[model samples]
Target chain A: MKRNLRIMVIDDENIVGKRLKPALEKEGDIVETFTDARNALERFSEQQFDIVVSDIRMDDIDGLEVLEQVLARSEKTKVIIITGYATVEVAQEALVKGAFDFIAKPFKPNDLRTIIEKAAKELGR
Target chain B: MNITSGEAPIQTDDPQFSHHGLGEEYVEDIALKSRPIISIRFRLFLAFLVIFAFSMIVALWSIYALSEIQVKIRFLEAAGNYLTEIQQARRFEKNFLLYGTNLEDSLEHLRTAESILQKNKDTIEKILGRNSIQGMSLQLNNYHKVLEKVGEAGDTEERNRYEPELREYGGQLVSDATNFVVKEREAVEDALSLSRRVPFYFLGILMVLIIVITSFLVKNILSTLNRFLEYTNRIGEGDFSPILPKRKYRDEFSQLGLAFNHMIRELDKRHKILIESHKLRAVGTLVAGVAHELNNPLNNTMLTAGLLEEDFERLPDEEKLDMVQDIIKETERSKVIVRNLLDFARASDYKIIAMDLENLLEGSIRLVHNRVKLAKIELQMKLTPDLPPVHGDEQALQQVFINLILNAVDALPPRGKITVTDSKSSQAGFIEIKVSDNGPGIPEHILPRIFDPFFTTKVKEKGTGLGLSVSQGFVRRLGGNITVESRVGGGTTFTVLLPTTEVPSSVSAAPSP
Candidate 1:
């Protein structure tokens, strides 16, 4: 029997986490979600997550900073950035700063599920 | 040089030519049309020609009149000389007749008088011609013969007879000479009168010529300048009506008029561009405000829709599943509209690259193919093979094409057609792509407002109204232009012109992903 994967979702909007948490949990992964990024980062240091999905824009501690801090804390954690204000520069910036992948908002949950599945496979490897 | 009242003054709407500017500062109160046609160069030339010709005529006439007077004076002197000789001969003849004892002195006087008479006869012949002098010459010869007879007479009676003949001859000679002098004086008077009249005739002809030439020159120069001034005034007032076409003679004024018209055309173009850019700026600000307000709500809807889908297993019924699907679908639609608004409002950090236009068009068509199929709309693509690449952001350009295609799909009824064609533009270094539809066309009244933000004819659920405006913005950012033409019952065509780029060797021939 394989051990369940650990995934964290961070967004300023409450609905984003509320929605993504159950979706990832349904795939037999342990999912932790947060609306406030600072609290998510505090929790992230206490426990290791195999994947971190974060919204780029937030009230405090944007996704890129979260991505850097998470990578600095643990090199193996896959950070996926999501943005409503998606542009080529923002995506490229996120990817260059060690985000595992970048996706625009208003995308399907299945799209995130696929990226998470690939991230999980990489974690197992 | 009087200007007629028939000509109208130039009118213009330009602020520079307003009453406070050109009217008050530059132009005088005199009606421009009523003002005399004044070309300084032509006027000066005419004045110079008239003055020079008049001076020449005056100089010539003075020389001619003075010479005539001199000839007349010479003739009078010649007549006086001949008359004096005739008086001297008469006195000598009378002395010879009265005093026979002083015959030697009388003969001497007679000989001197004969010599003077002979000299005067030649002069009179030269002056009056041979016929008038013939009688005088014969008279003088007869008087000389009579004198000889007096000198040779044996008695006083013979001498007295000869003296009477001599006196008769002398009297006839004096009368003929006096008659000749009087005729010469009359001829001189006639000649002097003719000389005086000649100058007036020449002056009359010259004056007529001067008037004709000056009038012609003044009118020609004045009318041309008047037209130029009128054109300038109209241009200053922002009226862009073309100037009069150039005349056959390509003079300085003609060249100036051509250059002036060219300048006006350029100014008009710049003014139009300035106005359009200002409109764009205003729209940009409005779109930014609206987009920011709409984005969060749209995001929330999308997330909530996702949450519904995530809890789909626990929702308990198929009806709920259908409703969740509807929410997701509707939310996706709203997200597209919000994205379009954001795209229009946001200042894109444009990444320009050499992109194959044919590939871009094909990819865009493929993106909307499913919708086109569902609508039963026929898609026709006629891309020019080996079409040149254009410099633009692929995603932005794709958005423009996708928006156009979707609009075409929306406009069409079942079995309608959408045709997209691309070709090299007739203008150098540019390519033209046309997206056309055979659906019911856009109305004429709303055609001008098609590119305006939030302007749409579609129902609230069907459109966000930002599509065409955002497409136009994207094209403009890529240094291209998009325009549309539609007739009421006829179909609509949207043409986009984009600048071509030189593809670098490193770039692959494959279409952009």
Candidate 2:
């Protein structure tokens, strides 16, 4: 029952991706890091991911567009939104766009793991 | 001018706040409407007027005197000419005898008389010219005609007729000259009298004017100075009273007074606003402190009740009612905390009363005793015997003492010691209550602002930042003051001073009670 889950880590800050990837992988999900949203789009065409943990505020293309692209590719993929600048409206929009949950930056690894497990359970349904 | 927020008051509304580098706000209000320059300018004008009047009088006197002297000289010259004319007439009579019945002798006599007449005419012309009189030349021509007729009389009959005519003309001339001299003398005398009296009159008038002007100037200056002195006294006494007295003169002093009054009024307004805002901030801090104090006990009651309910579920049925009673007791405790908070926060009309300061201190200690025991802090109380009563609100004074004691207990480490001592102060004529604690002392940078609202030294969630600020407010309301002495790693001591009075009232209860 172990599924190969494609998890995309989209972060413009190099340190966020570098630090978060290993920790997220420790939760037993495959993680791919992409600094550029455009390159991430090209990669998305070749492979499909189970969850996208992307930073919402990024240069050029934002996480909302990525979420839109991932949903168009496959409707069942669960998106997990993360950002340092969290506001009520943004959280509402993420839920409306079919994101599993929204997590603010500076969160502990345990909080992220909890959200990932919940999202995985919901996806199984 | 003072503004306050109902909750979480952070700033005071004061236009002249100490943000511009001035240490504390010292406002001086001076009205610009009253000034002395106006009176001074008016006095100067009066002095100038008096001097101008005196100069005019002197000028008039000089002109009158010079004219009178010229008149006297003219009158004397007229008298002298008249006497000379009479002498010449007598000489003509002698010449007439010498040249009797000879045409040449008569001609010589007439020619000599003609020469004398010419001299008289020249003298009259000279006098007339000086006086600017016209038409006197006609009289000279008539005299010359009479002289020619006398010279032409060669026979005895002609001589007799012409001699009588010449003598009659001479007599008329002498009489007219004498009449003119008499009139001129009278005119000269009148002019001299007027001239002699003019200096006296002029000097008298000048003296009067000088006195009036000098007095007016001094009066104006003195009045203005008096107003300034009164205003300065008012300012010294913190009154900011009016700086100008009413005056009628429209001058520069009036303008200066207006400006000064405006400045003073502005300063007064600013000062009043600052004091009012300070009071509002103090009240806000008081309410916030009470609210914060109640919140901690309320939280404890909730936690204690929850623990009791959980323990009840595990206990036997026989002890279930007892557990409910404990819950009820905690609920009552919570209610008491809320009531104390409300009473402390309630705005009451301030009324003065005799306060037993030692009893108030004991009451405050009793209120905080439970918390001190819960915190496991040692408490000590040392009150000097025969401490006098003060004048203030019992509840407000108790609240201040409670706040300070609670703050001391909060600052202490587990099992730390707190000492509160009270003694009569001889120098201050009051009682001094010192609350000292063996806790970590406050930092140097934060010591000055300990009484400022929203300033806290304790770690987050342990302190609400309004205790000392509210305590300071309550002490100030009672006409008392609180000061702190502290150093890092050493204990802190807060000394509160309350003025003592011999007014007995309901607050002078036994300390143990």
Best by DockQ: 1
Any runs in candidate 1 off by more than 4 Å, and if so which? A1-125, B1-43, B101-127, B163-168, B191-213, B237-246, B250-252, B282-286, B289-306, B316-513
Q: Tell me the deviation in Å of residue A74 in model 2.
A: 50
Model 1 C-alpha lDDT per residue in residues A1-125, reported as the tens digit of each score: 33488889998767577667766777888999999999999999899998899988665577889999999999999999987667789999999999999878677678898898788778873
Cα lDDT tens digits, model 2, B1-513, are 121111111225543443422222222212232223444555687689769977886898688678757956764674555546554653565366356534344345435534544555544455445332233223434544765666665765776676666666556655655655676667667778777888788778888888887887778777776776776554433343444436544455555555555555555555445445544544464454444344433333343344444454565776556545654764675576566545544566544677666677776775666567556688899888777777776666776677777788778877899999998765566788899998998888889878765578777555556556656765665667899999998989999888887554454553333
How far off is model 2, as Cα RMSD?
18.2
Q: What are the lDDT scores of the predictions, listed in order?
A: 0.70, 0.63
lDDT of 1 by residue, B1-513 (tens): 110111112434443233332223212122222334444565677677777877797789779877867876786666766666666666666776767655555456546545655656665676688877777768867776776778788877888877667888889878877887788788778878887787788778778877877787778778888988888776654455445543444445644655665565455545444434533543454354444334545655665576566676686687466546556765665565455444443444455678777778876665555457546688999988887788777656776787888888888897898999999998888899999999899999999889765578989756656567657766765678899999877999999999888556634433433
Q: Per-candidate TM vs. native?
A: 0.43, 0.41
Candidate 1, residue A82: the lDDT equals: 87
Off by over 4 Å in 2: A1-125, B1-44, B86-272, B283-292, B313-349, B359-385, B392-513
- Among all windows of 10 consecutive residues in model 1 chain B, the one with the lowest summed lDDT is B1-10
TM-score winner among the candidates?
Answer: 1
